[model samples]
Target: MNGLLEDARSLELDRLRHDVHDHPETGLHLPRTQQAVLGALDGLGLELRTGTALTSVVGVVSGARPGPTVLLRADLDALPFPDGPRHACGHDQHAAMLVGAAHLLAARRDRFAGDVLLMFQPGEEGHDGARLMLEEGLLDTTGSRPVAAYALHSSASAPAGQFSNTAGPALAANGTLTVTFHGAGGHGAWPHRARDPIPAVAELVTALSAVPARRFDPFDPVVLTVGSVHAGTRPNIVPAQARIEATLRALSDDTLARLAAVAERIAHGIGAAHDLEVRAEYTAGYPATVNDGAEADLVGAAVADLFGAERFLRGGRPALVSDDIGRVLAEIPGVMTGLGACPPGRDPATAPGNHAPDAAFDDSVLPDGAALLAEVALRRLAAADPAAG
Candidate 1:
C-alpha cells in the first residue's frame, strides 16, 4: 500500500490534470479524453475493452486470488457550456484520479483479491451514459454483478484533501422539461385578431420559478429553473409558436414526479387562459445517488487512515445535484464521496461552482485524491474476503 502511494506521488498527477483541463469535451464526444485514458491503461495486466455505446470505456483487472468484484467509476463527460469546456466540473481531475488509482492497484497486484472494474463513463451531465452502458449488457458481460462500487467527486467548497460522504441520498434525481405554446398570428396593428403566445410564455416562466420558492421547502433542496425560452421572431408580429425549456432537480423520486406534474398542469392552465395551444414534454433523468452503508463505512475508514480521522466527514444530507454514477450505485453496494478541491482561504459561496464559467479546482488535492482512491479500492477488496479480515 505504501509503495502504491509512492508510485502515485510520482505519476505526475497534476500534469495529467492540466492536460485534461486545457481540453474539455462535452458528453459522449470526448475523443481526446478517450484516447488519453486508453493510452494510460496500456500494458497493465488488466483486460481492457473500449468503445461501449459512444466513447464510454471499461477496464477489468482480476486478481490472482478469488474474492468479490469491486467497481470504481469516474465520469468522462463535461458540460455543454463554453465556460465548462475547461476545468469547470473537475472532470479532468476525476479522470486523472481514476487513472492513478488503476495504475497504483496494478503496481501492487499481490496485495488484494477479486477483480476491480474501472469504468470511465461519458455524458453524465444529462445523457444517462451509465444507464445506456448497462442496457448494452455491462453487468451481464462482466459476468457476476459487482459486490460493491465506489466513486468520488472534487469539491470547491471544502478545503483541499478533505473527504466527505453521506449515508443516504448523496445527490438528487434530475428531470428535463420542454413547453411549447402555439397561438394565431396576425398583423401588429390589428387589435384582438391574434392570440398571443408571449404572454403565456411569460406567465409560464413566472409560475415555474415560483415552484421552488413557494411550493417546496427551501431547506429541502429542490430546483426548477427555466434554462431557455423562445418566442416571436419580430417585435411587430407575435409568433405562432413559443418554446420553453427547463431542468428540474429533487432529492426523492416522489418530489421529482410531483414537480413534473405541477409543471405540466401549470403550463396547460396558462395556455388555456391565454387562448393558446400548449405542448409540454417531460423526461426523467438520473436517479438520486444513494451510498451503501457498509461500503460507505469502508471508504470512510480508508479516507480517515490516509488523511487523519479529523478530515473524514460521513454524515450529510443529500444535495440537489444529479449524478450518472448514481445508476452504478443502484446496482452495486458502493459510496461516492466528495474531495475538498476548494483552495484554502476561499469562500465556497464566492468560488465558482460546477458548470459555471469560472469554476476551478485546487491542484494540490491531486496526490491526495489519487492516494485516497487507491486506499479505498484496496480496503474494500480486502474487506470482501473474510480470510483477509
Candidate 2:
C-alpha cells in the first residue's frame, strides 16, 4: 500500500464514503452530491471548474515541472429505483476514492510532472454525463488534452481489495430496443374476428429472445432482455397496439449493430407472418469500453507493484455492464479497472451484485482504490517525461 494512505487519511476517506452514501443523488441533478465532492476537494490546490450543463466538477492539479497531461475520472450519480434513490452501484465510493486520489496527488505534486485532471462526473447511470462534459469542453479544460485517462469502478461481487481488468473490450455497448405491433381492435370473446396484436407481440418477443442464439455465432455473445410488455387494457376489449421494450448488450460494435439488425428483421418477419404492422426502433447508447493495450498493462503492473501480484487478475471476459466513461476511452488511450469492494467474509459469487437494491460496498477498499488511482497517474506522468522529475 502507498504510504500516502495513512490511518488518518483512510478514516477520512471512510467518512466521506459513508457521508456520500447516506445522501445518494441520481442523474445530472445531483446538486448535494456535487457540493459534497467540492467540499472534500476544497483544500487541494487545484484549479476547479463546475459544469455549466450538468453538476460536474473538474479539478486540475499541476506538477512542479512540465510534462504530458493525464485524466482520472470518477462518476458521481446513483441509480434511481421505483422506491427512491440508492447507491447500490457504489458510485459514492468512486467519488470518495477519486477525491482521496486528488488529495494524495496534490500533496505530492512536487514529486511528479504534468497535470492531473480529476473528473467528478454526473449522469453516468444512463444520461451520458461524460459526453455532455466533452461537449462543454472537458478536453480543452486542461489546455493540453490528456494523453491518457483512467477510471476505477467498485465491484460488489469481487473479492475485497483485488484489482481486475481486461485489455480489450472491458465493457459492452448498450442500446435500447423498442418494438410495436399494430392490429385491429375487437371484443376478446370474438378472437377470430379481432386479429389480436397481443399474440403477435408475444410471438415476436419469443422470436426476438431467440435471435442471439439463432442468428449470431455462439462465441460472440449478445444479450437481449425484454423488460416490459404492454398490450391490452381491459379483459373484454382487444387492444389495437402492443409494445415491447428491451435492452441490447454486446461486447463489440459490429456485434451490437448486427444484434439490432437481426432484431428488426425478426420483428418485421414475425409481424408480416401474422399480418400485423411492426415498428422497431433501436437507439444506440454507450459504446464498448476498449482499453488501450499498453495502458492496461500499465494498470496491471501498477496494481501488482502497489499491492502485489496476487491481488491482480488479468485477461478476464469483459463485463456486460455499460459505462459512459467508455466515451472518454473512445477519445483517448486509457483503461478503466475494477476494485473489489465486497464486504469481508461474504462470498463474492453469492453477494448482491452492482445495481441490486441490497448491494453493499466495503468501505475498507477506499484507501486502496485511491492509492491505486494516484499511483497510476504518477507512473503515467513519470513515464511520459522521466527526466522532468
Candidate 3:
C-alpha cells in the first residue's frame, strides 16, 4: 500500500509525535523542535528553507504537470509554562500529520499538477510566527502565489477523527485592552484626600464589558474578558495608579475596531469624571480566521469523501480563539479546519482544552489528518485548473 495509509498505520508517526511532544519548546526559537522536523523530513527530495527571523521550515513539492501552487501550513511551537514548555495545543500532532502529508504527496507527485508549499511555522502562540513568515516572503517561495492555502488545527474539544469548522468567520480576531488610571495616593481614613484610581478602574472594567452589548449587534459576537486587575498593595492604603488588563476577541476586524474605540472612550470618560489621568492602550492581535465560503464547502466535502459524512461537523458558530493562520488566509484564499484529536476513551465534549497542562491528543489522528490535507490540496489544485481535459 501507499505511504499515506501506511503512515496512518505506521508506528513511526507515533514515535515522531512523541519525539516532538516530549521535548516541547516555546516561542519563535525552537531549535530542538526544528531539528526534529528536519530529521523527519530528511531525504524527502523537497526544496527546503529555514526562516530568517524564527525557526520556521518551508518545503515545496512540485508536481509532474505544471499548474498553480497550494499551501499547507503547520505550526511548530508550544505553550510556555513555569515548569517549561508543553505541547498542550497538539501542535506536535499537527507537525506529524503535515510530515505524513509531505511523504504521501512526494511519493505520488506525478498524480497531481501543482506545487505544494509546506509551511512549518513557529510561535503561533501569540508571537505571530505566521506574520513573520509572510514578512519573510512566504507566498513568494513557490514563484506563484498559492491558489489556495489550507491548515488543520487539532481540537481537544471535538472527538477524535471528527472535523469541524464554520464558514465566514471561523475564528476571532484577538486584541488586548489595558487601562491605567493615575491618581494620588492617600490614607484609607479619608477618601476625599486622594483620587482613588481603583474605583475608576472598576468602573472602566464594567463599562468595557458592556460595550459589546450596547455597541455591537447581538447576532455578531464580541468577547471582553478582564484577565487581571492591579491596584494598591494594602487594603487601607490608596494606590497612585490602578490598571486593568483585558483580552478582546471579535469575529471581524471592524467589530474589534469599534469595540476598542468605544472601550477607550469610556475609559477616558470615566477617568475624566473621576478627575484622574487615564492611559488606555489597545493592542491589536491576530485578525479573524475568515474561511472562504467555497473553500469551507470543499473542506466538508473532502472530509465526507475521505472519512464519511459522520466525520464532518459544521459548527454553528465561530470559535473565539485567535489563530495566526488567519494571517495567511487574510493574504490568500483558504480555509482553516479543526480536527478532533481528543485521545481515545475520554469524552470529547469534556476533554481538557488546549494549553491546559493535562490536555491530551490521540496519535491515530496523525495519518488521517495527513491524508485529509493531501486530498484537500489535490482537490483544490484540480479545481483550480482551468485547462482540464
Q: TM-scores for all candidates?
A: 0.93, 0.97, 0.97
On a 0 to 100 scale, what is the lDDT of residue 169 in model 1? 80
lDDT of 1 by residue, 1-389 (tens): 47656778888878777777777788776888888888878888777776656787788877768777778888877666643455578888898899888888887777788778888888877788888877876665457678888888998776677788988888999899999998998767873898888888999998899998888877666889999998877778867889999999987778888889989999999999998898999999998888888878887888776768988888977788888888887887788899888876678767767777766788878777778777877787787788786
| lDDT per model vs. reference | 0.82, 0.90, 0.89
Candidate 2: list runs displaced more than 4 Å: 7-11, 386-389
Judging by lDDT against the true structure, name the best candidate: 2
Error of 3 at 183 (Å): 0.6
Please, what are the lDDT tens digits per residue for candidate 3 over residues 1-389? 23455555563677888999999988999999999988898988999999999999999989888899999999989898888889999899999989888888888888888899999999999999999999999999988999899999998867889898788998999899899999999999888999999888888888877888887888899998899999999989989999999999999999899888888888889999999998999999999999998888888998887779999988657889999999999999899989988887789788899988889998878888998888888888888777654
Residue 113's lDDT within candidate 1 is: 83
Sort by lDDT, best first. Answer: 2, 3, 1
**CA-RMSD of model 2:** 1.4
lDDT of prediction 3: 0.89
Off by over 4 Å in 1: 1-4, 82-84, 217-221, 344-349
lDDT of 2 by residue, 1-389 (tens): 44765732554798888888999898897999999999998987799999988999999999998878999999999999899998999899999999999989988899888899999999999999999999999988768899999999999999999898889888999999999999889998887787688988888788888888888887878899999999888999988999999999998888999999888888899889888888999999999999998999999999888878999998988888899989999999999998999998789999999999989999889988888889999989988996954
Candidate 3 ranges with C-alpha deviation above 4 Å: 1-3, 386-388
